[model samples]
Target: MTASGLPMPGGTGGERELLEQWLDLHRATLAAKCEGLSDEQLRRTSAPPSGLTLLGLVRHLADVERHWFRRMWRDEDSAPLYCTETDRALGFVVTEADTGAEALAVWRREVDRARKAAAERALDEVAVHPRRTDWQTSLRWMYLHMIGEYARHNGHADLLRERIDGATGF
Candidate 1:
């Protein structure tokens, strides 16, 4: 277990097992769309997928980071700053006014919240869900769930970006 007490990304020996490898692949996929592109390139989206661009991916991840780690775990009373405040229906929609720099900033802010929430709770600590009256989960479970969620959506991002530029992979 690393600082989080959930095994390190590749384990202690630096050998990545099935799950870690899977998660890393998706993480790279998510990060790849933002590469080799300026603010303009990252913000372009074509058809389908609701024209969701990479900057929007960053924005959504920022929302995800806040939803799972911060508000759900730390402060349920507080509203999600990035998601609900922005377009509720189209969280992934990329606008012409959006910029890569702004999206990155939003993502970093949410990530900071995630880290703070993680630091406050232990692996086995249970968080009560304010919205979902029936749900409660350990911090460890939330961590695993979050990474999995990101990995899945990152796959979506990979396909979307590939269709955009024919420049494959994450």
Candidate 2:
């Protein structure tokens, strides 16, 4: 558990295998981004003028997955995974308390919620989008979106991690 009290579940063999693969890859990529780094290192903004950090990416993607997979596509009445209309920039702003442990907890919790939402319906099941004026998406669509979003961010994470501590190649 790396002294974090979170068991790192090994292997991806639950629900859909391909879906599990995507989730595993993203999860590993996030870990890679913060690997060999201390809390302060993870929380430091990369660019002097910009407010972006490895920890923030973890926080942001957790909220992103929850917002799309849980809130919008699942039509969930649950609260947002993090942030709200009140704090739009919370994802990019890391505080002293935003440690690896806290970030991983949020990510895992949101992922669990997303999996529940995804499992409750078939791939063809549809939900009206909260933002689009005329849009409806299937469970499959949301799944694909979440996977694709994380994959894209994983690339960004690779670059950012390299800049942070000369670590690369995930």
Candidate 3:
């Protein structure tokens, strides 16, 4: 178990299993950052000039998971969850009305869908990049990219959580 009371991923596993386990660990880390915080607290910005918040990170990551796993990897024609053509920062702009529970649920659903999509294919399978149409990458690359993405954002989440109530840990 981690200091946050979430189960840490095992040190031993196959490549795919290990990657998934690490991803899950990061997911749980994000959730732990929000644990015991109120909806208002979850929506609280890190500072006056910044719009970043724990709830916003949850929403943004949900959209990111859907985009990468379902849309890009699976070639589904899904739209963005919180972002739009006009407003790309919607996910990072939480209001007082937004509930942390709903955002967490959506994030969990996206993570589950992403895992299912990844499980359906081999790590060597290639997918076309959504933006870079001429480029292709393997599922392994996608997993690594997602791991990096979560790691970077989780750092931000850590800071935000610390700012909220001084709770900090891996």
TM-score of each: 0.75, 0.79, 0.93
Query: What digit string (tens of lDDT, one per residue) describes model 3 on residues 10-109?
Result: 7897999888888888888888888889999998888777889999999999998998899877899878889874676887878788899999999999
Winner of 2 and 3 under lDDT: 3
Q: Highest lDDT: give the candidate number.
A: 3
Candidate 2 per-residue C-alpha lDDT over 30-93 given as tens digits, one digit per residue, 9 for 90 to 100: 7767777888888877666777888888888888877777777567765655577678677767
* Clash pairs (backbone) in predicted model 2: none
Candidate 3, 22: how far from true, in Å? Answer: 0.7
Q: Which has the higher TM-score value, candidate number 1 or candidate number 2?
A: 2
Q: What is the lDDT of residue 63 in candidate 1?
A: 77
Report the error of model 3 at residue 85, Å.
Answer: 4.5
Candidate 1 runs further than 4 Å off: 1-8, 12-29, 85-88
- C-alpha lDDT of all candidate models, in order: 0.67, 0.73, 0.88
Provide C-alpha RMSD values for all models, in order. Answer: 5.6, 4.9, 1.5
Could you tell me which 10 consecutive residues in candidate 2 have the lowest summed lDDT? 1-10
In angstroms, give how far residue 97 of model 3 lies from its true place.
Answer: 2.1
For residues 1-170, what per-residue lDDT tens digits would candidate 1 score against the true structure? Answer: 33423333553443224444444445445665666677777877756546677777778777777777886778656566546754654567677787878777777776666777777776778987767869888777776777788777776677667766787642
Clashing pairs for predicted structure model 3, backbone only: none
Q: Which candidate is the best by TM-score?
A: 3
Query: How many steric overlaps does candidate 1 have?
Result: 0
Candidate 1 minimal-lDDT segment of 10 residues = 11-20
Task: Indicate the TM-score of model 3.
Answer: 0.93
